[model samples]
Target: MVLATPVYCKYYSKSVPYEPVRLQKTNLRFYLHDILSGPNPTAVPIVRPNQFGALVAIDDPLTEGPEITSKKIGNARGMYILASQGTDLTLVLYVDLGFTTGEFNGSSLSVLSRNPILENPREMAVVGGRGRFRQASGFITVKTQYLNTTTGDAVLEYNVEVVHP
Candidate 1:
């Protein structure tokens, strides 16, 4: 029998783009609740560690104006894994968020991030994507604007810097 071997190659330097497109949106919050039931159920926790799921309605300023309305141009939902890491008791989270509709109507955007959740300003990597955002890769910055403890409702702002062809 002939011996089989594996070969690997590595590159030290990579070319960088001069200018990358930046997308910014403010006053965006995800209303996570069951709509068919009428009025927020107020039974679920806004956030928790480990596996969790919710039906999200993306409230954007352009379409919904400033008021919180049921009209959603798109949907946002994700699964998460949260736990303590290292000696500092840092709350590390693994999040996979999927987006559809609006600018992402036909296609979808998938974001995967493994980072500390306790931080005021957090960043996540755009590992993969589909549709208009096909092969999209970049980083996103998240800022929590508001959080309602009782209803588990929150407002978050996002700044995305991405490279797509």
Candidate 2:
């Protein structure tokens, strides 16, 4: 019998708000388990390098309210997954939201993964609704592990952008 375990990887955005409110590009890199050595027959080697992506949007609506006339915002997220030489594993990613408008407040969004099952065994989520109004900025993230059930480590890379008008 073989038992599988879960691995955790976290990505954080720059603490500064995307100024100039224009389309921009960013990159995020995550380091996995340390390298191994020696002639080990049962040792699993690292195969994947890292993941990368871009954020795209077109005049997307981000905020709307009686006080504010029309504050349209557009944004998209992209991700890349690296290859691995392990058995079966699970990866988890998390996102942190910062500050925004009242309309988006108290509203939650879901984060989808290429490999749904490998994302999270419990659920696929991003931002939370509760306590959103009080928070100036929040966080959001996605997670996924190698395709092996072995107990090893790996790396994760994330790249995003915020386009504005």
Candidate 3:
């Protein structure tokens, strides 16, 4: 009188309704200007009371091209914290990139990942998003296009690939 054989499969379809959705891939390339030392720095350090770690908040500009003079597109707004306990310039970053022009206007994508600053090209995961990029999942690769350690300014080239419905 025992007929229990994997109850999960029996009700799996009932509990989770299947809906047909079409996902599209979007590729975007932009540049971020991280100015850490200038008078109008885009990235600033947060002095914590405990002062045990390092954290920098950023509202950096996103441009259509790698150069600073390129047409402004949007902003990469978020924060990056020191991830490594040692001398490795690694960072845990969280950012929301919002577009201001073109077809992607009003849409945004979010990313949370570890950034190895010393690496030539760093890869990061795009967790989620809103607007046109709802339920987004993808990755972004960044390369330091230009950097001035003296002024603490950097221009990073970002290539993003995202899939969304």
Candidate 4:
């Protein structure tokens, strides 16, 4: 499946915040095709642990993009994860230029720890019987960093697709 525009978040210090920072906007492109044949291809059908959420698998080939500036600042590290508002399970499919190497050379794709899943709010009640059905949503987040700087724009591209049983 094709991915949409990524959501960007900036990190700045209140004491000495960086100003006039413009992140170079880069588009990550890729697709995840279902593996129909393989030793355990069918067994790994992109399972979503949360019944109310969805499962997204990002292809490793497309993880290159821009890098966040000011990574030295506290919490300057940026991350991308999947999140959901309802009972649907949210799965982080792919992440752009947030790796150690800081390039989308197809290296950090196996880094699943960086991505996390978000669950629905339990305090709220379900409406329209939709409560029983939980789905998963695919999303990405870019946290505190200089995406666009004088050096250049670090653009990472990757692909993620949803699979359901």
Candidate 5:
């Protein structure tokens, strides 16, 4: 006698925020400290040759503190491409961040950008958004500060401007 095996599968529909708030095109800046590795990491480090990806936690004061465990406003995921020779190498990035407490809690903003990687300061389009940032469209500025080359770690300063209503 043999026993039969059971298989289960599930699917979820596209997610959309409920009664999302709206805002006008405004400029916001923040510093993201990406730790390639540490004792405990809020965001894991991932890197590849053709493509590299990382989940970086937002740092509040531009300095390393206890933000990794608590007080983390939001997180960012960045993907990049390495070109043999070209003017455009950096692909794009998505930033999701907002207030951590009070009525503004849980109401986050998302920004989609497409900018060059090598450029010291470049502009990228803000494609989409969610939560309090619905119907968003604008641009973002990126600046890279190399911290550690061996571990492939660095700090990215982003200046976001968007309009939503």
Candidate 6:
């Protein structure tokens, strides 16, 4: 239900006033398995389809590779809004990604951005984080590696670089 909260919600985290004593940058490549058609789909449309203001809630698996059978290292959960009014497909995305089995085991990142979903490789902003990634800052580039129109399933490749403390 956190996704229901507005991006500009009244509740907020005051900015970190000081710089981290040491900053570390972590680069990772992963994939998101978006199953939007099966009986128990991970991503589902919550609003009128293909229309402006439409919303989609996502609880997709983040894997080590494009294959769904690959190692499941993390999870991506959030929502995106179809913000475009014309033919272009643009969305305002908000996601919280967390790793479960890798070096980033307990860390998580908060992301927010507006991107053209159809773009080959779209970038998003990393706003903050928790655990080892506290006070994080960076960007993530994503691409739709594979999509099954008939079943509404997709495999998305993600390249993330985060400077954190």
lDDT (CA) per prediction: 0.48, 0.29, 0.88, 0.28, 0.56, 0.89
Estimate candidate 1's alpha-carbon lDDT, on a 0 to 1 scale: 0.48
Enumerate residue pairs that collide in model 5. 25-162, 25-163, 90-117
Can you give the TM-score per candidate against the true fold? 0.52, 0.21, 0.85, 0.25, 0.57, 0.84
Q: Candidate 6 clashing pairs?
A: none
Predicted structure 5: lDDT: 0.56
Q: How many backbone clashes does candidate 6 have?
A: 0
Give the CA lDDT, 0 to 100, for residue 154 in model 1: 49
Whole-model alpha-carbon lDDT for candidate 2: 0.29
Query: On a 0 to 100 scale, what is the lDDT of residue 97 in model 5?
Result: 53
lDDT of 2 by residue, 1-165 (tens): 999888797886778665553332222222122112234322232333432222211111222221113342211222223223343332333323222434444333323333333444233333332242221222223233332335332222222222112
lDDT of 6 at 16: 69
Q: Find the number of clashing residue pairs for candidate 5.
A: 3
Worst 10-residue lDDT window for candidate 5 reads: 58-67
Error of 2 at 50 (Å): 29
lDDT (tens digit, per residue) of candidate 1 on 1-165: 999899798878988878855643322334332222225432233554343332223322212222246455454444333344443323233333345446555654466665454566777677756666676678777665666655445455555666665
Superposition-based RMSD of candidate 4 using all C-alpha atoms, in angstroms? 21.3
lDDT of model 6 at residue 72? Answer: 97
